[model samples]
Each structure stands twice: as structure tokens, then as C-alpha cells.
Target: MLEGTEAVLAAQLRRLLPHLDERQRRLVMGAAAGVLGRGGIRVVARAAGVVESTVSRGAGELDRGPELSGRVRAVGAGRKRLVEADPGLIPALLALVEPDQRGDPESPLRWTVKSTRNWPPS
Candidate 1:
């Protein structure tokens, strides 16, 4: 369990994690854990729901100071874009939501009201 400021920091980290890229999250967690000093790895790992080794790697990266071309995440680390993953997705969506023969000349789903309830589960 965390105590006082550590708890607050952990909560803030949790809130910010989704908005951050993987490396950023790791770096932030590692830095905060560093501030906590000894036993910080275990504390931060538990709070962040990440393995201790991950936090340790982040700490190492922090100490190393962007030697790897200042890149946050390594090359080709994230999920591919939707268009790349599914070439036909745009055409299918256009066909479904196109308003007329022009077929969304300006934009697809521009005038259409879309809701989660109307979307089919993939």
C-alpha cells in the first residue's frame, strides 16, 4: 500500500497513464519511483500495475538520458493505424454511411448521427 504523497502520486499516474504513450508512462513512473528512493521499484511497480523489471528498465532509461536518438518508444513499437491494418474498412464504412450518390463527397458521417448502439460489433 502507498502512503500520503505516494498515494496521491500513484493516483495521478493512474489518471495520466491512458493519455500518455508507453515510454512516457514508464518514464514518469520511473522518475516518481526514483524520488521515493529505496524500495521505490516495488512500490511503483505495484501501484502502476507493471512488472518491477519494466520500472527498472525505465529507471535505467532515465539515467541513460536519451542516448537512443531521444526516442520515447523504440521504432515500430505501437499498434499499426486502422487503415494500414484493414484496407477495406474505409470503403465499407463509406458505403454504410454515405448519404447519397455523391457518397460523402465532402465527408462521410458528416451529416449522419452515429451512436455506439448502432455500430455492429466487429
Candidate 2:
């Protein structure tokens, strides 16, 4: 690509990236690189101020089709909630949050005294 074209792509990336979501940015950059053909990944990466690997990943995503549409990452990519792992955590946290609200006596957390450390009741 021409040196002037490199600057144009950089300007375009600057203007467009802020308006796009993470996935969209990657897709756009990937598309640009794909259209540019050989050596486009490095050029796009430099223009976008991101690692070449990010552009490469985007190109891979484009090749992978629309399976990842509308989502920045695959489903279940993040950490699970504490409440998910511990069913009794919510009641325990709620009891802690509202000291005056009596909790079920049978609950193991009923005997837990007030402590500085507490979680959100919601």
C-alpha cells in the first residue's frame, strides 16, 4: 500500500473505532486487512495501534463466519458468580446486610456475627 494510504487508514481507524464495539472494531480492521491482501495485517495493526495478533484473531473470526455475531466473546467466557457456586451465600449476605431482619434459625449462617466484611444484599 502507498504511504499516503497508510495515513488514510490510520485516520479512518481513529474516526471509526470509537463508534464501534470491541468485536466490531476487530471485524472492521480484519476486513480492511483482508481487502489489502498480503502484508495488510501488519499495516492494519500499526494503523489501529493494536498488536498484530489482535488483527490476526479478527481475520480468523471473519473466516469463522457469523457464529460469533452480536457477541464480543464466546458464551460463558467470564468467571461464574459466587452465588452460583454457593446457594446459601445470598441469604447469608442478606442476613449480614440487615442485622435486624431475623433469618432462618436452621441456616448455618444464622449464628454468624456482624463483621466488617460484607457483600451486597441484592
Candidate 3:
């Protein structure tokens, strides 16, 4: 449908988010949710193309004291990368992916012939 309410709101948020830093984006999205009141977090999040938690953070921020600095996030606030935090992860992943250059026997492609005829299933 042309000019639907949800579509217009989503477009606005998509257009706006790129211009804002992380914290500002959260606050803006949160405010949008706050305006809607109750379940606004879900609506604003979907419209803003962000997770519900992000919107929730913004809403929580609104209820608290003013921001103290220009920091976008708290120290070590987010999750760590799998590769960085666990060295064993690489070995484990490589073992699964045929680390020694030999193919894994359990792979789905193990029995499939590597040919163009097999590629498109002619």
C-alpha cells in the first residue's frame, strides 16, 4: 500500500539513524517508543531497524540522570568476538572445516561430484 503509517515511520527512522551515533540513536528510538507508551519499545525498534534491547536501553536512559560524557557505550559493555576471546575456537572451527586439507567424511558435499552437471542439476 502507498504511504502506509508503518512504512513512513520506518523510512523516517532508517533515514535518521545513520546520522546519529550509537547512544543518540538509542535515545531517539527510545523516545519514539516512549511516545507510543507500552510496547513502544517493540514498535520503535522494528521501525528503527534495531534490536528491542537497544530501544530499551534508551528508555532506561531517559529514566536516569543525564549523560556524563560523550561516550557511546560503557567500558567493555558489549560481547567479545568469538575468535578473540577463545583461541581454541579457531582450532575447533578448522577441525570442522577440514583443517588438514583433507575433506571431512561427514560433509554433505563429500559424495557430490564437483562438476558443472552437478552444479545446476540439469
Candidate 4:
């Protein structure tokens, strides 16, 4: 009966993935995995195509109650912005956009005109 329930839950999660946001999906998977008890992380992770760590974190969140806001991902979640990830990125962009230097000819933005208001503040 447990195996049958796991299979059913896995199928439901797979079908629901496209419609639900990351947090919602994780919650559903975590809840289902929690119901299965022991070894549920591995089972649900395989079924959901997510890592065990993700399911583990989801389980942790479930235990902690509603901590997240309206957003799908938690605050400061996902990849860091390019500027934050690479200190050199802003300098490289500045060098390209500054006067007296030719920007990358291959860049699609090279042909497009942009207003100063649209540019990021230095």
C-alpha cells in the first residue's frame, strides 16, 4: 500500500510541476515524502528530478512552518546577480559603454540605441 501510494504521489507531483511554483512543488513533494516516512527523501527526489538536499531542505522548511513570503523562492535564493557574482562585470560593462572605445561588434546591443536613463547608475 505504501509503494502504491508513493507511485500515485510521484505521478501527481510530475503532472503538477509545470503548474506550481518551486516552493509549492517542494512543499507538495516534502509533504508526500513525510507521509512515507523513512527513506522518503530518496524516493521523492528521484521521482521529482530534484536532489535529495532540495527535498531535505523542503522537509526542514515544512517542519519550521510558513517562513517564506509570497515569492516562490526564499529571499536571496537562486543564483546571484552577475554584478554580485563577478566584481569585474561592472568594470567590463563600463569599459564597453564609455566613450572613445569601440564595444563588441558581435554584441546585439551594439546596433541598438539606449537612453542614459535606461543605463544602470554608476
What's the TM-score of each model vs. the native?
0.55, 0.61, 0.58, 0.60
CA displacement after TM-score superposition, residue 92 of candidate 2 (Å): 16
Rank by lDDT, highest first.
2, 1, 4, 3
Candidate 1 global lDDT: 0.79
Residue pairs with backbone atoms closer than 3 Å in model 3 (clashes): none
- The digit string of per-residue lDDT tens for model 2 on 1-122 reads 67587899999999999998878888899999999899999999999999999899889989999853567877897779998989999888776657654568677564445544664433
Quality of model 4 by C-alpha lDDT:
0.78
| Predicted structure 4, TM vs. truth | 0.60
Worst 10 residues of 3 by lDDT: 108-117
Which of 2 and 3 is the better model by lDDT? Answer: 2
Over 1-122, each residue of candidate 3 has an lDDT whose tens digit, in order, gives 22464567798898998999888898888888888787778877877777899999998998895788768889878889988898799788656545334456676453333455655536
Q: Which stretches of candidate 1 lie over 4 Å from their true place?
A: 1-22, 35-38, 97-99, 103-122
Stretch of 10 with least lDDT, candidate 2? 113-122
Instruction: Give each model's clash number.
Output: 0, 0, 0, 0
Top lDDT: which candidate number?
Answer: 2
TM-score of decoy 3: 0.58
